[model samples]
Target: MAKISLRPLDDRVVVQPQEAEEMTAGGIVLPDAAREKPLRGTIVAVGPGKMLDSGNRGELTVAVGDTVIYGRYGGSDIEVDGKEMKILRESDILAKVL
Candidate 1:
């Protein structure tokens, strides 16, 4: 894959979604339409921390290269350099994969 030039702003992050499952546990192949949207992804880019009330930037816990799980319907889908990506607010991320 080509390197993406996108840079998110203000606590937003760019994620490269994991590929959807192609087969079930029973070894049944699933068609594309039957595949579920991926909830897991790797952070490709990160924004500067969000602005805080004290005029200081609040630090974000996640960073580039972090693998995370997000809400099922959170974030906006986008295409960058012909690759599908998601732009999510820091708050939209559910958990960081250990």
Candidate 2:
């Protein structure tokens, strides 16, 4: 696949979600119907911080290449180069994966 060149705008982020585990540690293979949406992903792109009413932009806590966890229903699903991705607001991010 080609490198994604998308740039988010205004506190938004482009995330590439991790694929769901197909098997458990106990060797149980899960079917597609049993899989859930992944809440974790790596940040592929970041937008500038949110614009403040005072004309200053708020700082963004997350940076590019950071792995993040978000709300289950938070982001908008999108596809780029036939690969699934999510676009979410910075506020939607729950935690950074160190």
Candidate 3:
């Protein structure tokens, strides 16, 4: 696949979601209908942080390549070079994966 050139605007981030596991830990294979949409992803691209009312931009805690977990139904899905990606606000991010 070609490199992605898309960059997000202020406070927005472009995430590359992790693929869902086809099989459970118990070795049960799940069908497509039984699989849940992944809420975890790596931060591929990030915006220049949110603009504050004080006229300064707030710093973003997460950087590129950071694996983060977000809300179950957050973000907008986008396709780049045939790869699925998500774009969402920093607020949508729930936790950083260790």
Candidate 4:
């Protein structure tokens, strides 16, 4: 894989969408229309931590290259360098994907 990466501006982070989880029930393969949309993604790039007014660092809990599960209603969808991605503040991240 190419190691190309972009730094997110300000307090934003970049995430690449992950494939949907497998469905195993009655030995049936689900159709695309029947599958739930994936709400988790792989971290690709991240910005420097959000800065503080006091000239101190506001640490971001997540870093680049982590798998994360995010809220479906959060984030602004985007395409960075022709790859689909989400741009959101670190606070918008819900949890790390196990």
Best by TM-score: 1
Model 2, which residues run further than 4 Å from truth?
none
Model 2 steric clash pairs: none
Q: Which stretches of candidate 4 lie over 4 Å from their true place?
A: 1-5, 21-24
Please report, in order, the local distance difference test score of every candidate based on alpha carbons.
0.94, 0.92, 0.91, 0.77
lDDT for each residue of candidate 1 in 1-75, tens digit (9 for 90 to 100): 345899898899999999999999999999999999999999999899899999988888998889999999999
**How many angstroms is residue 85 displaced in model 3 relative to the true structure, after the best TM-score fit?**
0.4
- Tell how far residue 46 is off in model 3, in angstroms: 0.2
Lowest-lDDT window of 10 residues in candidate 4?
1-10
lDDT of 4 by residue, 1-98 (tens): 23436778767788887876566577677778877767888878788877789997677778778888888877888776677788777878889966
Position 44, candidate 4: lDDT:
80
Q: Cα deviation of 32 in candidate 4 (Å)?
A: 3.3
TM-scores of the candidates are 0.96, 0.93, 0.92, 0.77
Reference-based lDDT, residue 35, model 2: 83
TM-score of 2: 0.93
Model 1 compared with the native: what TM-score? Answer: 0.96
Give the better candidate number (1 or 4) by TM-score. Answer: 1
Worst lDDT 10-window in candidate 3 = 1-10
Candidate 2 structure lDDT:
0.92
22-82, model 2: which lDDT tens digit per residue?
9988999999999888999999888988999999999899988899999999989999988
